[model samples]
Target: MTTPAKPTKNFRFVTGNDPDFFKDKKIVSANRSFVMFQQAKKPCDGIDPLKPQPQRVEKASKRCDASRPQPRTASIPAGAVTETPCPPGMSSDDALGLFRGDRRARKRLVDRPQPNQRVLNQILSLKAEDLPFATPNATDMCSFYALLQTEAAQGVLASRGKLTDGQLLFEAAYEGFMSTFPLRVVGSPHDTFEVLPKFKGDFKSSMEELKCHCSATFSCPNLGRTWIPKATSSKLSFLSTLCISAAHLDAMRGERSIWAPLMGQMIPLLRIMTADRTLNTSDQAIISVLQVLLGTMIACQEVSSNIHWQGLAQLVTLRGGLLQLDPVIAMMISIHSVESSILSESPIVPEYLEFLRQRRERSQPGQPIRYSPLYSNQVELMELRHDPYCSHNTYELLCDIYSLTNLISIMRSPIAELKNFQSLDDMEAERQSICARIACLPSAFSGDSKDLSRRARIVRYRFESCRIAALIYSNAILNGCSFSYAASQITPAFASSVKKDPAPRQNGRNTRSDSLPSIYRNRPVTITSYLKQLLARSDTSGLWGPLSGVLLFVALIGGTAARENLPVPTSATDLGTDSYNVKDRSWMAAVAVRCGVQLGFEYQGTMEKTLVALADVTRMSERCDSAVVEGWRASQEPEILEKSLHDGNGSLGNTSAPQTRFTEATTNEIHIERVSEGWPSTTGQADPSSIDWGFLNGI
Candidate 1:
């Protein structure tokens, strides 16, 4: 037996006991064994035995080891709109027509063999890297590499879960945060604004020297200028890459509104890019900040911001101040600042309107900022400047009005910029600067209401009404002044006073002995009553006719101020914000409803978004539980989550928008539902606990 075993050992085995042998190899040397039934420790919905069960748990590093996000697809590059129009029977791809001239060719067309549009696109889209600006410097390369690292890390994140409910995240037990998209936007070798702007200056110039910086992000084109935002090309800078990606994701969020996952990935990258103190004021850095801000506005179609506007504003200030900023962008920032002030009902740092005033002075050296006497508060309304091609006057006036409301807001609420104040004087200086801003308003239309056209008069009345409301609100905040006092304060006597004297006061001192004007000497009237009477005397006769834009601003300020000091409704039954009774109809609610509806905004999200916009633009804000607050007459049933299987019943009638009917109500007691445009009114009170904060201004 020992001799036979020794002989066997001398011969090598053909297969596995030598590795693949008894290891369940296929056929005679099969490696794996087949089981009749695949079993889990417990029952599950999973169709695959290898896959983790839905109920309890699964190992992620094993089962959920999804591939990293894919590399970005080649984006369709866009060039200047000057290309030859697409030929007949062809699509936009043929927009640049083929060389259909004589086959003999005068000088031989480019791409002679096959008229390729991409050749033209390549030439047009190529960034001249040889140029000084395009050439990579140390900082740009560093930023590019850091961004690259961030992208690589972001790609490693597993995205293998479903978010069944409305709320934003998906859960993979092993990984903290998971996304649904298999692939996300990643930086590519070639990426930039799909639709390039016709550069007005040196196209190769760096951002700081570049003359044409459209407010639109490099990820997209100017809103209505093109049907949709085009894909990014290779022209964009690394500093703005994160912002553009974030914005592009926002823009392409067609049917799905899941921004949480996208924002989660991008925000960290943005923070990383902006974290370094050295890059805070860098040109590309500022561009990144502004792109995020502008991108947010473009996506939501709302001027109000829920992002880092303070950091953005700081970057703008550090760079060169908003005055040196692009005109369109500067104005938008100024408006946003003013609205934000109103929303938070507090002061923003370094008042944005100061930049506007400086811009005005730079544009017109001799003409000083002039104040409108129609405003009880000082505001720089444009009266002297006129341009047939542009409506700078209206815009300037609106800006001033926003600034004034902002001032009033500051007086009422806690200032957010206080932490940034270098000294206590900075606060007082802010107040003084606000006063100066008001004094700078153009007053050409303030003095002579009689000289104004009917159209002009209507406009003046509407806006001036806002001025009065702001004054009243400020007065209330300061001295708890009554509506009558508010009415008396709005005296348009400055022009008359100047005309009567024909002499500049010795030291430009106000010499008036009586605070109350002559007309109000013996009369007792409220602002709301006075405004109604004045409107009655006007050509339009009421707050009716063409309405949109700044009218919402007026409604919030004027309506809130005009509302007689009724005790704010504490109970669900008490709803009227204004009296709609005949003979004493304040019409404040009516004006609010009319202005809100005239906005033509869809019923959904109107309340939240508009409320937010009004607060920003006008500084007038009111509290309402938008989520629970039903429309004119909506009803809802609580969703029964426990019961997943239903007998398949149709949903209840659409109580999404409420209904209303005219009825005689003798008392001031009325439904808040009556004048709601965005918020539908319900018969019962809304739950105060549920509120949507999307549109709320800072306050």
Candidate 2:
């Protein structure tokens, strides 16, 4: 502008060279001189080539200058832009465009599936108290068929959703039934699902609906009807048909879609069926139903939660009691046993024992017992009296008793006698055989009959009983206690010789006195005396030594008694009167002395010892009576007189003390002195009124 300033290399004005340059600057110099002058006057003018301006000061001044000018901003025209939401049924892209055109309409539409109007409408239209029962109509059948198809489709879709959404469907179905058919819903779908089989596809929805119906039926108790009976009958009819239809359909599809719903319906239907007696008429069907029910109940979570033995027991006892349902009951008991065994610290051992005891008691004699109750009770009674089963039961019972100390003692008591002695003869023989086997043993086996370590105590008592019986019977025979002839016939030679030996007097020791033969006297004396002494030192210690001594003594005594050639005493008084009565008659004396010694020992020992000793003594006395009777009969003695003495002696042994002596003077006054002194007391005193022995033994 200053003389149209000559074009300058550093300062040239060119149009459209830089668009921002025109906007930034108001004018440009054409000449370099003028440009220099203008630049010099400006604050950005360079004073020297190396010098530079402070950017902070320049920026601050520019900002201050800009602040001085009025603030400006671009304005949007009203017609230039707008926002509008698409129509209600429009796509999202259309709505987005509408939103861009008209902003106010953006809030109108939200993307969400329409409420399941069909299912809701179906539920809303359903009338209370009018459940959808099967009808012989095309329209109703078609609607049900269509509903089934729709449910199957919905279930497929729902299966693809989150598990939480699937659960929501179940809950929604339950709620719908609760709201529409309040009379048909029972407890809760959650509870039902715990017991029901997991259904798939549309069947899952159907199950939910079924559960809802059952719950509704049971909910209204005031409807003049029991829901259990009605529901059971209806379900029985419905499920039977449904199962058949499903089976047919599954056959065609080669799939088991109905299996889930069928299983799901089984438990509740079973409860219904069991509730009505009429529904149980078909034996095979009932059994099948029960089987299915049992399987379901066993598999159910609710069963685990609600399990109780008493309920199971009640079920077993129903209808015909345990006898009629023993198989089922046994299965249940077995299950309980296993469970109790697993969970309990000390399982129900006593209960098992009680069961065995009751079974044994109820069993009759001589019947073929069946393990299975399906057989006649008569068969069981037959078997109970004989053979393998009775013995088997006895063994099992014994094992159970052995497990408990208290039970062992109870079973061991004499009160536990066999119901019939004849019937138990084989068992007794077996027991005796076992005892004999043990006796023959050189050492105690690991499985000894005795339960405690102090076995000698038991053996000692048993040996004492045997000795006492032998002594009493031999004395009665030798003393001629009205049965001398009988005694002579029955007494063995060795026992007779021993009984006739003279007494070893208390006077100056007679080394070679005119006593009985040494063989007869010393051997019996040595053995019996050793046993008595060993038994006298009665302590649990040195058990084997004492037991061995007793066993040896018993063997010698039994061997001598069995020889069958021993002499016999003439009368009871002969036993007391002879100078050798204390020695020749010492066998009886030894018996009495041992009895007294045992009593005294027991009095000094424990209560258990005393009781055991008493029992041993009682058993000995009984055996004595039996032996005396045998000896009397074999000798052809006066039956009446012999019976009296034998019976009297037995009674006396039981009631009187061993230390109580019968004086000779009193014995003679009572006409028993001779017998008491080793002569037959009734040798010369014949009573005509006495019965003859010839007729007694069928002679």
Per-residue alpha-carbon lDDT of model 2 for 1-699, expressed as tens digits? 454233333333233345564443122211222333334444455455432233433343345447457445332221221222212354544445454474444573844333344554543443322323221322211222233245554564364443343333333333233122122324434343332224444663354454453343223322114213332333243243234233323322324455445655554544544455554433323333433332222222133213433334444445444445433333224332322221111123334323422431233355222221111123332433343212332222222211221222333467547446663554433332332222121211112333443344343334332333233223332222211222233222122233222556357443332321122223332223323332332331222231222222232232222222223335322222222222222232222222222222221111112223222222333333444444434443456546768778422232111111112221212122231232223211222111111111110
Q: What is the lDDT of candidate 2?
A: 0.31
lDDT of 1 by residue, 1-699 (tens): 353122221121222124433332122211101111123333478553453232222122223224644344321111211132322343322222222221332453652232233322322333312111122223211221222234332332222122122111111100111222111113522222221122223222222221122222221223223211211211222323333333333332221132323334435545755666665655555545554553443233222344468678677767678757655445445544543343233444345645433432122355222222222132233432342211444445555544545555454456645545464445444543443333223322334345455556555544444444444443332222333222233332111122222234458553431311211211223444444433332222222322233344443444344433333222212222233211122233233333332221222122223344344333222221121122211222234311322545433332332222222223422222223254333232222111111101110
Cα lDDT over the full model 1: 0.33
lDDT of 1 at 24: 24
Which candidate number has the best TM-score? 1
Task: Tell me the spans in candidate 2 whose CA falls farther than 4 Å from its real position.
Answer: 1-307, 326-328, 334-699
Listed in order, each prediction's TM-score against the native is 0.28, 0.19
